[model samples]
Target: MFILKRQDVEISSIQHPKRKQNIPILTYQGQSFRLISVFSDHQQEEAKAFWRELTDHRGKACVLLEETDRFSIWGKVSLEQLRAEESSNSAVSTYTKACILVLQAVYIDVEDLLGGRQAGLFQKDITNLFEKLKFPQADSPKAVKHWLNVDPLSNSSVPAWEEHHLITLLQELYRLGKEYFGNTNFAQGVRDILQDMPANDQNQFIDWLNQSALGQLWQ
Candidate 1:
């Protein structure tokens, strides 16, 4: 089982001063994670160095992102590099991107529930990243509805905006698992994380997974 433990560390205690923002010190099982984010070359270099430090222990590493930070040039360049590295047999990079997508989805859902300002920005960044990853396009209202498992005739009966965002999140999960982890282990990894989530989130994600095209994989 995968376990996530989040710890609060002082700024003065941060080993890398230059890459300080949004840095969450998360641990899976007993392995410490090196969470990195990039908004420029300097941050990108820091991320690369962090990756190197993992060496044979890279499986414990992942990415940390904020909704506002994902749209920057630094974010784009950093993700592009990570995606490229994924294709080159870097398991750590692949898992980092996958984990980021899941976290981004959860962030969007929380923001929408609370009527937060950054929901739109999160949605846009999620869409852009999915496109860059070559996942199926949820470009049209109809496409979004399909992915969300909403009945076409009930479109007017549902909250379209929330449904659309949920679909985007589900599709990212499905595609990431399918494209990178052969649609099996990654689904299990997601299930492991879901088990640790709040009851509300667990129910929501479980419902979506059961309704999605990738439902059988999860089963």
Candidate 2:
């Protein structure tokens, strides 16, 4: 039996035409895995909580999306989402992208520190350690879900050196702010950019920053 932990699973509803209401089901590659009850009044809140739990056990947990057959690492998903959202021109979106890049750099650095990659395998044992901080917009949850279901091990090459590059980019952003807006504190500049973000996004960004290398420097 393929037992899945409740903490590792997220329940999404699908239409049940005959029943005239939505039914909560867990499916993987068109196979019915489990049926779970819908108890939470707010579906988005429940999903966010589930994601946080998954993030806490990222390396140990295997994320299996109902729409995909393969399990994926948390880091791959975070990277995919970061790439997807990086094009947005909004202030919050830009700041969030930078933060994700920083986290990814740290992740890669840690992987390098543990052991140089062995030939024929791409850090298979390294956990992708990051959270899906933003809630998916209602218009494209399925697409977002699919994008995050990436198999990190499928890649043949290690990520290019990024820690110093990303740090330089962050410093450049801070410099631009100081030159153009007279904001001396980089953290304050980040706060200003995030001013218009929704409360949930702001809170998630704060949490992510607190765990980042930049956050350590700021402190």
Best by TM-score: 1
Residue 17 of model 1 has an lDDT of 33
Question: For model 2, where is the 10-residue window of minimal lDDT?
Answer: 125-134
lDDT of candidate 1 over 1-219, digit per residue (tens): 121112322111222332222222333334343332222223444334433333323332343322222211111123334335434333222222333445444544436553556544444554564444333335543443343343322233322122223333444545443443343444444555545444655555555555433355444
Flag regions of model 1 displaced more than 4 Å.
Answer: 1-42, 53-105, 112-117, 136-193, 196-219
What's the TM for model 1?
Answer: 0.27
- Tens-digit lDDT track for model 2 on 1-219? 233444545556654333233434454433443231111222334333333443453332323232232222122222233344334324344343444433333333334543444310212211111112112221243432322332222322222212222333343333333443344443444444445545666666566556544454432
TM-score for each of the candidates: 0.27, 0.23
- Candidate 1, residue 102: the lDDT equals 53
Name the weakest run of 10 consecutive residues (lDDT summed) in model 1. 68-77
> Which pairs clash inside model 1?
39-74
Candidates in order: C-alpha RMSD to true structure: 16.8, 16.8
Clash totals for all models, in order?
Answer: 1, 1
